[model samples]
Target chain A: MESVLEVKGLSKKYPSFELKSVGFHVDPGMVMGFVGRNGAGKTTTLKSILNLVHPDAGSVRVFGLDFMENEDVIKQQIGYAVGGVSYYNRKRICDIVAVTKMFYENWDDSEYKHYLNAFKLDENKKLKELSSGMKVKFYLTLALSHHAKLLILDEPTSGLDPVSREEITDIFTKLAQKGVAILFSTHITSDLDRCADSITYIKNGELMFSGNKSEFIRSYTESMGKVPSLEEIMVFIEKEEVVL
Target chain B: MGKLLKKEMKLTASPLSYWFILFSFMTFLPGYPILVGGFFVCLGIFFTYQQAVEYDDITFSALLPIRKKDVVKAKYAFVIIIQMISFVLSALFTVLRMTLLSEAKVYLVNQMMNANLFYLGFLLLVFAVFNTCFMKGFFKTAYRIGKPFIIFCIAGFLLIGVGEMLHHLPGMEALNSTSGTSLIQAFVLLFGIVIYVVQTLISMNSSERNFEKIDL
Candidate 1:
């Protein structure tokens, strides 16, 4: 398959929100930034893609296999991380890893230890005691150490300091270089400019833009008669009405 | 499923099982079976879904590779494990009491007694009722705290009411005797077992369907 992840015509309805015909794709060895404001259905879309949430319509395919039909086989090749690591909070980092590593058939112990050393993570500390940045690193380490070919991350660096954010961005790029497809959903536009090869913007549970990052910018520039960064465009979309 | 059970045991058994084992220190004393069995029954129903969602553990587990139904299945497996623990501890305590302190007659009193088949039946019936009430409310959404609480309270009150009424009845005292197991007692225990197995199957099926229809 050309794309490692493909979501087509996805739909879901909540009492107050809905994702209508939402679709996106990410090719191998590329990063697709899912950009949107808070409550814009970025997380919902990601969750549906990973089957964390059941969708009302459409389908998701990973590695050319139907996601719903081949959940185990498809998920074995995908590693998902939400905004933060939340599980067994009172357990030590190493203990949590020990329990979690058993779930993945291809868990690499040397890779896990290597990442721990590189990130300077203390294995003995309880998860509740770790800094938010360290928690993100721990999650990323788990995702990477499983030999996964795809990473679905929802706001992986949202609450981190600049140094941690930069470090995480570097890791995403490095993983992409190793032929891993990454679909990272974040509202922080600057993170995308640094690492995203393309952008998919969702607003009010709808896709407003999905294309080359430069082309998306140029379209807005031509329409508004001014060049705007992604952050400016997102703010304008939130604060004022604009045509996509 | 083995991996799923392993994860479930790691999450549910460690700390809770430790608490029960500590409680088992008083096992040789009478009422040991009822004590541990009651604790597990209450705890199993209470901890299934509401606690996980409240703690964001549901989100974490959903992000894992396991299917949604596997979560419900693991919980059923956990319940069986709880019952087995109660049984083993009860047997150990019963054997110890009989071997060491039979002359004291402390294990045969009305209020205090060693583990028996009747008590096992009572435990089974309680859990069977519990799963029926709880699985209905839990399958809707893991966050429906009020419904299951009300269900448990009603179940508890009814069982206690039955116990009180039996005390008032004249000939019912014979049912509590610690003599050879009776034919009627065997039938009651068999019925309780049937109910537990059937309710467990229904609970798993209902929960699987309920979870499938939900957004999360």
Candidate 2:
């Protein structure tokens, strides 16, 4: 299968924290769960791949193109959801969509309306007025409407209600079936249990494990001598990584 | 780049507040220096500069497919467009000032015709210096207002001081004469344009480089 995304030797340094040589890949038609504790380089890694942060040394390839060389072209086919930003607070939802639509080459207004209707969003509402869950829905709607081939979401499910989470998870499944690669970070491990085909777990700026989801769980069971839920497996892995 | 410009116009389009400032400023158009000076202050303080470093705008643009360099370019383009609007408005106000208050301010209109071309040139230089200063190290968006303002304040004062000295030169006829500006003032106007172009180019290059290194 052709990989939709690839990160190699990605490293970023900060005053108090450093993301040291982390790497991973996600193929087309696959949904990869990016699991990490708070400040474990999940957002940093994502930002690096997006070139939001200039990495100290690394290469990021998306759709077989070096992201730095073909950033504009590659980004057109990718949707990034950094949830619940209070950008343009004075602008209405309709205005935001209008402006954002012009940025993408393949923005679908009809598809956007369908998501707005399905999500029960009011286009006239200001961004400041939307609840956290509603904001995530808005971001997702923006991503999906752009006809993006790959969706990269950063902690999009954190404040969402259970029902909204389920709804979005369903949308991800549908997107993946349509051959849209997905890589989302979520603390809600159960969301992944039903959706993610692969998992990459990170801790303190290191990848603890990156492979098939079931194999990750089975590795935990084999090492710890018992089966555990995904969340339990995460805690065990972090603990083991710390001990090592 | 056109797409980048389009996105920038959309981002800066704060319908009410934006128009409100323009309307209010136009209502009280002042002399050459004050009119254009007020325009920059209002735009910098109330809109573009604030918007330039906005956390949300930065984050939002990062999600778009455009190059990091284009983001900086688009920002510069927006400021330039705002300056162009001010130019158009100033020209109209000059006409209104000359026609409506013709007899009372004959000198102002005369200045508009000849030597006062220096005013437009000076304003462009001031705005370029101001934006260039503000955009350098822009990623450190917070607590940076004072530095650039101070630098621009000195530039403003220096320009005034130089103009004052030039006005007193021995060969100079009265600066307020109805005939037109002297040859020296024309040279000064050309000089201002030179500085504007060179400074703006330097600023654009540096801002692009600094922004790429910034951890957004």
Candidate 3:
């Protein structure tokens, strides 16, 4: 398989918004940062790829296998973490894991225990008792414990403190080093700068760019006649569009 | 599907649902509208779905290595199990009312629906209506429960009212008999079981389709 994840011709329409043929691909061992402004269709595109939101038109391939046709098999190899995963506030972490681990045949109890200990997570704690950062760690722990070859995280670091964000990005870097392909959506460009090997930018439900992070930066410098941080490029484009 | 069903039972189901099975004993209550027992049992199952939504259970299930339709299937399975358990309890009380309490004056003179084989049939009808109306309506949005549940309450109670009124009709008094079963009572019981099975299967199919359109 050339790409760990590939999405093409993705489209969906709402009364007020439309995602028009968005496309992107992530190669194996690559950390691809999906960037977009609020309501820019980042979540929609990610959901479409996962078939959470049925795309009006598109095809998604994961590990070179058709996603829809081989959904169960494909999903087994993918670790999907939604932004704010609060499951049953009254249930303890071990109880939740007890229910979750049954679905995966390759569930690694030892790996789960390792992530639990490494993250300093108390398995006895209820979901409501955990802080926001701890919840993120817990979700990552679930995602990583199943021997996933691909990780798709939606806003994993949003609403987190700088320390927590740094910690998560560090984990992402290490995972990428171990050949686990990751596609993470975030508003935090700094996290991407720290770990992203490639970038995919969306604006108003359209694909603006999808390529090497340095190449995206170089393209912006050549056109604007100035070096710009990833954050600046995003802001500059949105601001420039309003001027037009 | 087995794993998903396990998740539904161990994770999403509420303890109140199991407790609500006791509602079947309302059959032993003299002169009261025992039909409401079936409605209360369904209400308990409704709480499970309500809690699932509050806890973002759909999103969690979506993240699992299973189809969205399988999530609906598991919920329906859990619901059927609860409903059947309630039905069995209600049937046991119905048998006692017919055999042991047949001559009890309070029951003999009761103007409401009697706990008999015919009543068992109507109880199944009540569950059938609940599964059809409530399950289909909830899956349309995959989140809202209040409206669908209210709709079920109306349908279920209306069925009970009809079941009670049938015994008052000039030629339908056999339906109110608290003793040995007649051919008509046996037929009604069989019919009720069929309706429960068929209606639930049809509702399950539509619910799975409606849930597929929902973007969790």
Comparing chain B with the reference, what is the TM-score for each candidate? 0.78, 0.72, 0.96
User: Which DockQ values do the candidates obtain, in the order shown?
Assistant: 0.58, 0.57, 0.76
Across residues B24-90, which tens digit of lDDT does each residue of candidate 1 receive? 4454555433434554545654654445555466566666677877877876677666766665665
Candidate 2 per-residue lDDT over residues B58-157, each given as its tens digit:
7787668777778778877766666666655654554454455445543444322222444445656656666666555353442255666666667656
The DockQ ranking, best first, is: 3, 1, 2
Docking class of 3: medium
**Native contact fraction, candidates in order:** 0.58, 0.77, 0.79
Sorting all predicted structures by TM-score, with the top scorer first, yields: 3, 1, 2
TM-score of chain A of each: 0.94, 0.93, 0.96
* Native-referenced Cα lDDT, model 3: 0.90
- The digit string of per-residue lDDT tens for model 2 on A12-95 reads 888999998988899998999999888899999998999888899889999999999998898888988865556676668998
Which candidate ranks first by lDDT, i.e. highest?
Answer: 3
Q: In order, what lDDT does every prediction score?
A: 0.74, 0.72, 0.90
lDDT of 1 by residue, A35-94 (tens): 998899998999899787889999998998899998877776788877665667767888
Candidate 3 lDDT tens digits, A150-200: 999999898888998999999899989989999999978999989999999
Give the Cα-based TM-score of candidate 2 against the true structure.
0.86
Q: What stretches of model 1 exceed 4 Å from their correct place?
A: A241-244, B12-14, B21-41, B44-51, B91-115
